[model samples]
Target: MLDNKLTYVVGANIKDEKLRDYLKYTENLSGRFIKSSGLTGKIRVNNNVAKLNHRISSDDVIDIDMKTDEHQNIEPEKMEIDVAYEDIDLIIINKRPGIVVHPTHGYPSGTLANGVLYYFKEKNEKCIVRLVSRLDMDTSGLIIIAKNQYSHMALARDMQSKDVSSKESNDKDLNNKIFEKSYIAVAHGNMENKSGTIDLPIGNPNQDSARREVCDEGQRSITHYEVIKSFKNADLLKVTLETGRTHQIRVHLSHIGHPLYGDSLYGTVESEYIDRQALHAYKLIIPHPRTGEQLTVESNLPEDINNLISKLKSEA
Candidate 1:
């Protein structure tokens, strides 16, 4: 229903630590970005693109691509979603472990989208799959749901360009677009520093590889980390991404001599939770696609992780 372009630099950050708060609290605001950038476009974020409550930072440029288009009806799904928060414009859900964000293989059904579709189907809300962000199949945390297509494009644009990016590849090598993303993880050993950054290039090793290798020819990747807690034999840390590559967190941690506990792909199988890696997405920040507002979401540790931490601390 909004139909005006608005833009600004955030003068103050409300108590709402997440940008979605602003989207929900402000009446005139239409869109925002959690991790915004320098760019311009005509994208009106709707309820479907991103939530309004996400955190927006001060001195950050914002633009609102207010909707001038006809309305489309979307229904809501009553499917059990651990909704961190919700509004007409966006939905933030805590994704369960072991569920892929999108469909593939024999997982066309029983996915998060499947539950979402069924929930919306029951509510008669005109809903569609316009996810603003993606989480790994086993990663559990806040998953952002953009309600519409315009906001999807706007948000997607900013996420795709947060890091050093390029679009040039030789005919012999037509695969090169680099971006950075941060993460939080529990490492198996004691690191010497309070914080550090890891730079590595991740790339394909063979045709259609599910695994990535550490190579100089690979794309550029960076991961920054700070120890949050130290356990008897393990440590908890918050990782900030500087690039977005498949398994970037896992790979970076492994490369930096602190592989994630139980990480079968990279680390030794000497941890308590052998089936799961000790990594959880604790926070996500971005700018709203439609309104250019800043947004952020934080999640508490999953029960499995908390239990492990507790047990580790008890031993200490």
Candidate 2:
């Protein structure tokens, strides 16, 4: 069952702090959320309804019912969804390629968000759909959806706090990060190096243009890639991002002279094995928003990318 309440036992570290301040800092709750919860009388101290200014002491029990009457603007539609993992705080969906993540200008309905809302409604959950991470319409992989305002706020803050300038890309460094996203792709050339880092700034040249390129005056973007296998004409590479920029992996791989196979927007090569970009978001490691425990979720490569890999191997 989904628990919509948060219970915190005051410790020495937070003793004597104001409830509002404790909620904002220690619990990572947004001011708006705190105000709303307070207005709705959802916060209690020691089983009694408490005000925001209530003084907290060690061993005091804090209970917060996080349920809200918030409603989504998008209409829920029944559709098949691949749920990779689900808990009280978050849902990790293994998104297939060629599906929009949410409703946008061009896509008004029939999105993953619509399906998720239907799923939630069927399960009698009355929370807003909050996307912690996003993927392009054609990029298949895992995407995160926060189940409540508190989880959404916490996860969003963690994503923003990521340090993209760090030079380390090893497993230890990745584990230390609040969130780690990994991808697998087939690039159009035999990589000269087995492993390398692409430290480049990315920005769109024109405000209206959707394409992004490396520029001196752009946001700092970093991508770390390791060639997993070499093929006659292409290479299978595992990629990890230090920064999440629009089209980061595509732009980085193309900039390094190894564009992904079948990438129409960024690649110069035409592929017969696949009709879309041979890229997949395969893994994610995140800290649970409420519990602070590490969670690792992964999705297997979709069939198109796998078929592309097999074709490359046969050509070798």
The TM-score measured for candidate 1 stands at 0.69
Best by lDDT: 2
For residues 1-316, write the lDDT of model 2, one tens digit per residue: 4478989888877668899998887766779888988888999999999999999988899999987778989899999999999998999999999899999999999999999999999999886789999998889999999998889887876766664544333335334656888999999888888999999999988888888999998889989999999989888999998789999999999998999888888997565678888889999988888777789999889989988888788888
Question: What is the alpha-carbon lDDT for the whole of candidate 2?
Answer: 0.87
Question: lDDT for each of the candidates?
Answer: 0.63, 0.87
Residue-level lDDT of model 1, residues 111-171, one tens digit each, is 7877776665566566576687677787777777766555665455555555545332221
Q: Per-residue lDDT for 100 in model 1?
A: 76
The superposed Cα distance between candidate 1 and the true structure at residue 180, in angstroms, equals 10
Which candidate number would show the highest TM-score if scored against the true structure? 2
